[model samples]
Target chain A: MKKTMTRFIPFFIMASFLVTGCNQNIKSTTTAAKPSVSTEAKKDQGPVYKGKVVGKSNKAKQISIEVGKDKDAKTVMVSFDDKTKGLEYAAAGEGAIIAYEMRDGVPFATVIKPKLATLPPGVTVITPTEVKTLIDSNKDFLLVDSRPGNRYSASHLPGAVSIPVCEMQELLQNLPKEKDKLLIFYCGGPT
Target chain B: MSTKSAGQAVKAGYKNIRVMLAGEPAWVKAGYPTYANYGWVCRGNIVLIDLRSAEKDAAARIPRSVSMPFADFADNYDEIPIKAPVVLYSDKDEETTAAMKILHDNGYKKVSLVEGNFLGWKRVGGSLEKGPVVTDVRWKRILAEGEVSVAEFERALADPKVATILDVRTKAEVASGKFPSSQHIPLDELCKDMDQFVCKIRDLQKDEKIYIHCTTGARAEMAYKELKKRDFNAFYLVAEVDCKGNDCSIEE
Candidate 1:
């Protein structure tokens, strides 16, 4: 009975980890009531902005976000303070969902959290075990390491071809010409 | 990078694209074999091991390779550093794979096999040695380019006049605490607002020394690159740092 319980311990811990991870993702991606709008969040409040952070001025205590859902999105500058949550995530190239209040026509961020970028449709995530099984079974698939060339040269998956993302444009020829062939890509891991 | 690449692949009209989310590290942790190209075997900073027999190794072996016969690898593998990037090859692919498994199973993080093995090396005209085999592994991790030694950073911290300490961590990170007499500019902010930051530091001479640091040195390196573009004599700390209300410690 003790041995059996010990074997189950790892599963229980993994289950808890998965639960926490899912909850965290849900909270960050869905906290804002409104999506892609600078409308007033509540009574006497300014507005909530959801978009990718474009530029920042730490000295000015302001971050610029390309707000809205369209390509012609306007950049809005939002100020933050010590009280602001997720200030670390307020950087260029990172997605942010900011809840702010306007004071004298200036937006002051009350809460700032990272907006997780969901994976696009058609591209699916494969586990390492699944990939290993494919290799073991002699599957006809192209496993490409999409990290830097140096990293690829240092070490990479067995039978994996090197087509670094940085050099993807120039090295497109290295990729299989047949469009229908399965192409599995991997990097340093989910960052 | 994989996701971005996969997206690009989709755009390029490739169908059935799948991303290995866990990637090489996870694959390695699962005791799977990895392969390195011949160029890496020749030039990479790795402990290349010839896993063939002592007789075969003495007869002919890859240059700069140490002989660790697969028969004796189980007992003597620990002699190689745990952190060393290990590359192995032998006449028999099975022996090479088995040796790699032993290293991975025993907590070696970076282990790979030479692509195509011994005959492959010969075909590529790889340098070779004969007569005797090197038994001992001689390796030491080197600091990356533009990196400051921890001791030097500590000295600069003690004496602010030695070098201007630049803290490139984010505002949230700084809210906890930071070192004394250090200039603050988050990496992203510095990169985005280069003109503004340059104007602020306009008074300093171009040759003035600066030591930059972040939580884990990744951001510091980025900041260092930006500073270098502006021709500032800058070096980044490549080590972990912990701070509490102006008191801090660094580790490599």
Candidate 2:
């Protein structure tokens, strides 16, 4: 029964999301269980993100990817579990594309593939270098650090303040009313 | 409105914006005001623009109102006067919010939606003037406002010390061709990259007039505004400019 519940946990959470609409405080919890039994396991992997694998930690279940090419790159983090694949030969400084899903505001990899990822569209993905340039110039723009509260307060990019994407909906009033304000959102890469 | 609307506005590059507390329906119920007749439209104080299909505009429109379809208005919104009150309307009052927001975002000082829109105008006994629409109403304003004249540019070319020609298009776009002795700083990277932009600022020669231009005039015009906002002596190039290889010409 525990194993059955473990297998259905992500599905149940997703169903709850559909019913409740944008739930905050989603627990980033997962249980180890038997892997998928189906032949379409490859297709079950999630959305793709491509970049250089800057770091890896099997113990913490995290991998960092440097999206964008050359010197203008932004690093992102992705969490993995017993199910994540394609990491056996992944080395630091190698290009990779990761398929992922967000649970409890934390992104987790379903499949790790080898390729340069052009992020799926929502917001324009600008590099950290671009952000550094803006900061260095003293040009005014809102740099939002969309990470957990603890992570943000502990350490964040210069000139960035915490406004986690999970709670961004309710925090509209806190945002700038000025029309010219260029808003930039970033979190731990991929994760 | 969703918080994501803020992200969308930022993506769209708006300078002034406002979110209406109550929608049109509520505003209508309060019955503050919609619009008066076309006589109110033609006071020479307010500019009336029709946001409708060309076919719809060709069928009928208020006298002296310009037919600047929403698509065109969105593309060349910088052409619209930021200081003057712009009254806009579309079929059956649709697109009033969108038009108002676009103008609002572009820093238009005064923006009003035709209360009832096109149908409302007719129902309220406003006359519909048929025939070809006048689209050049804003053209005069676009050139006269802050743009550099061809004569001014010609004089500048004669003396580089008098004015600095800055091209804000992409490196790839300029690799093919550009104006003689013009400084190149790609506009997209200006805010974020600023490798070239910084060089100019640090090497600021405040006395020299800066003439900024892009392929057509939009991005150049925008860059000029940014410089002027920072109190730089910058002028926006409004003329059509074509360049091939190392050769370039500004149209008369």
Candidate 3:
């Protein structure tokens, strides 16, 4: 028994060395390739926006705002806050300047300075038609139906997925990780 | 297998994205084909629960339905009489489906999910109840302990004994509100950040208390459960309030 154990000891050591060496090689390969994966993730960042209203709608409480139009020409629909309900209003074809910030391609008008067209850094003005056209051209973008599934199922933009904004975070993990993907969101107007 | 919009694709972290300005209206105007409503059966006695917030309840709902938002569903589950046919519908089926599963696992034997959800009901010309059907006693007992008004919560904040206030809203919501001096830890990310909570309470006695809140209280309740599971003694402060903003008004 002792002789047999001695004979197998060298084989065991050799096998262990081989397994450890292969694992090290795999680890090194993964380590060397990790930076590219992260960089790719970073490259997927969407268009960011800044700036404000460049147009308006005739309908009460409806206004057309332009932000970051020079670089991306993003346009958004805006309405007055409760405190500013009776302030001077613009008719259709009228434009107003506003300040805004957007991240991961989602835009929100943060500050509104009416009557003064102060273009912030990295901002541009674009027509609604241009915004629509830009959206149509992007094939890899993600179109989200912010309405309920019933509305989504009844009728939705071509290739859009139903994910009501109310449930955005619950479904976030299921969303793709690529940054270049455009996420377009819409509701029944403001609701 | 449904169509995707450019904006949705982008928000989903996809590289390419877009938005149809007209949204569903545009889809209809473009002459895109629509689908027929599918039928869904209630799992049991068919108590259809609308999980939309009170604000949305006024817009529309399924016939013979009760209203409860996803946030309030768990606490309110006991309010739903057990052993009845329980069906859940929401603006989005995904959320309702999730809520239904929660009910099912919690031992509600006769639960069924409404097919096509509320939208389908509307498409079929189903009648809608304006305003929420007031929650019955069963619901009140099972789901809500009532809300702590904002003013009351503010008063609590002033109390020296209220050592901590945890906000379980999503990071996005936290960033949007940036509520003064509150620690923001999304409910989903709570487990990962447990140490932060632990560290905050490390010096406190075992019976020491902490306060928690969310946009309403649903998430706060869920977070409260998780905290208890982790052996932390915490209490949830229900706001019992509706959203206040430029958006259209919705009556509960």
Candidate 4:
């Protein structure tokens, strides 16, 4: 009886080895057949820009993307094909990033994503030089002073007029009629 | 009012409504022209609340504006008149919104948030005043309450009745580590997701008390106030809780 049991044990061990080897081969073959699943997962995890479509010039299907909080970021105009879907458009606001691809000189916006935009670190405030250039270049712009009338009386920009943001709508008539004119506005800090 | 984010100057039957990014601060920093005060030239009684640092006040400020620092805002409240048209001015909209909330809560009838905050004021070459004005007295009433200590909060967490723990910190902050069993609802997006949070709270049972915490006590306090205003029983954890074998630092 002992001899018979020993022979059966060896047979059982060989059968188990064959089954395990067969399972391993099957698993390796299945893995080798499909490789795109892992690659597709990696592709989905790509960089995404969150911005808004600030401006759309008629002549050029160019849309401006302003990134970051406070709209402190400069406007970046990217041209999109006229065939682009209007459904792809997004509203302009804080934390909006319009993602587009630049091919040659034209840009094609593929997606518009909104994020909790943040100001870029180390960006200096708008300088006097910039203001001068804006005023000189944009003659038809409206210049609004957000300060109170008393403060406006003390001093103000040459062509600027006081229209406190609180009462801006009421004083709309005081604003320039031309759309192309650059509007320059200012306010006083803590004092 | 149209539903639009701040600084969105869209042309809604108007030509070239440009919203300045930094408003007045950018204008002042640019060394542009400014006036003295809301002049006698304008009609209607307008009250200005100035939110600037003590140092900035020495340079220039809006005349007739009551000085109110953004940090120590709650310290001055009584200065705000309840019946006047209140206009809040700050370097940024963050402070303006804070001030507007305070004023609105105190029974101020007409409150308008300056579009660009204070920076918008200067962009149009407005006005300025140079002097230290008396701060508002209403801030004292805005003192935060219901802050639980860290140890006390941990003890409270042990109670199974505390069904939901909310972390109001930004996503970036939560990526580091968060208290066990706490879900994230950033402060900025809290209003947007308030319905989802309420639904979750209801699923857990309306009687279940919700605990909230942020990097620091400030955001948690804000969350607690906002939730309570919406009739939710919310508590703010004032101190940091232990997470991942390390103490969570409360951002100030």
Best by TM-score: 1
Tens digits of per-residue lDDT, candidate 3, A129-190, equal 43356556864555555666655543344455667655646457546676654455443321
User: DockQ numbers for every candidate?
Assistant: 0.30, 0.04, 0.08, 0.07
Per-residue CA lDDT of model 4 for B174-198, tens digit only, reads 7768765566777655644567776
Q: List the residue pairs that clash in candidate 1.
A: none
lDDT order of candidates, top first: 1, 2, 4, 3
RMSD of 1: 9.9
- What digit string (tens of lDDT, one per residue) describes model 2 on residues A48-76? 66656655645345666666655765556
lDDT of 2: 0.56
Grade the docking of candidate 2. incorrect
Over B101-165, each residue of candidate 2 has an lDDT whose tens digit, in order, gives 67665666445656467887889887788887777655233354668887888777778766888
Could you tell me the lDDT of residue B179 within candidate 1?
94
**How accurate locally is residue B214 in candidate 4, as Cα lDDT from 0 to 100?**
70
**Candidate that beats the other on lDDT, 2 or 3, i.e. the better one:** 2
iRMS of each prediction? 7.9, 22.0, 20.3, 23.8
lDDT of 3 by residue, B1-252 (tens): 111222233335454432222333333222332222223232112456778887787666665567788887888888776645466678886677678667766766445444466776778776666764656633222223433445545665666465466666665555445445456676645644556766654364556665677655555665665576566667776554222332211111
Model 2 stretches with alpha carbons more than 4 Å out: A1-191, B1-40, B43-155, B158-162, B170-172, B185-204, B217-230, B238-240, B249-252
Greater lDDT among 1 and 2 belongs to 1
True contacts kept of each: 0.64, 0.04, 0.18, 0.16
CAPRI-style docking class of model 1 based on DockQ = acceptable
lDDT, residue A6, model 2: 62
When only chain A is evaluated, what TM-score does every model earn? Answer: 0.48, 0.41, 0.31, 0.30
lDDT of 1 by residue, A1-191 (tens): 35543543453333221111010121212323212211222332446787766555554566777676556666666777889776866766555678898776667888776553233346555667879999999999999887788888989987888887777676577778999999998777311
The parts of candidate 3 lying over 4 Å away from their true place are A1-191, B1-152, B200-205, B240-252
Evaluated at residue A92, the lDDT of candidate 2 is 53
Error of 2 at A59 (Å): 43
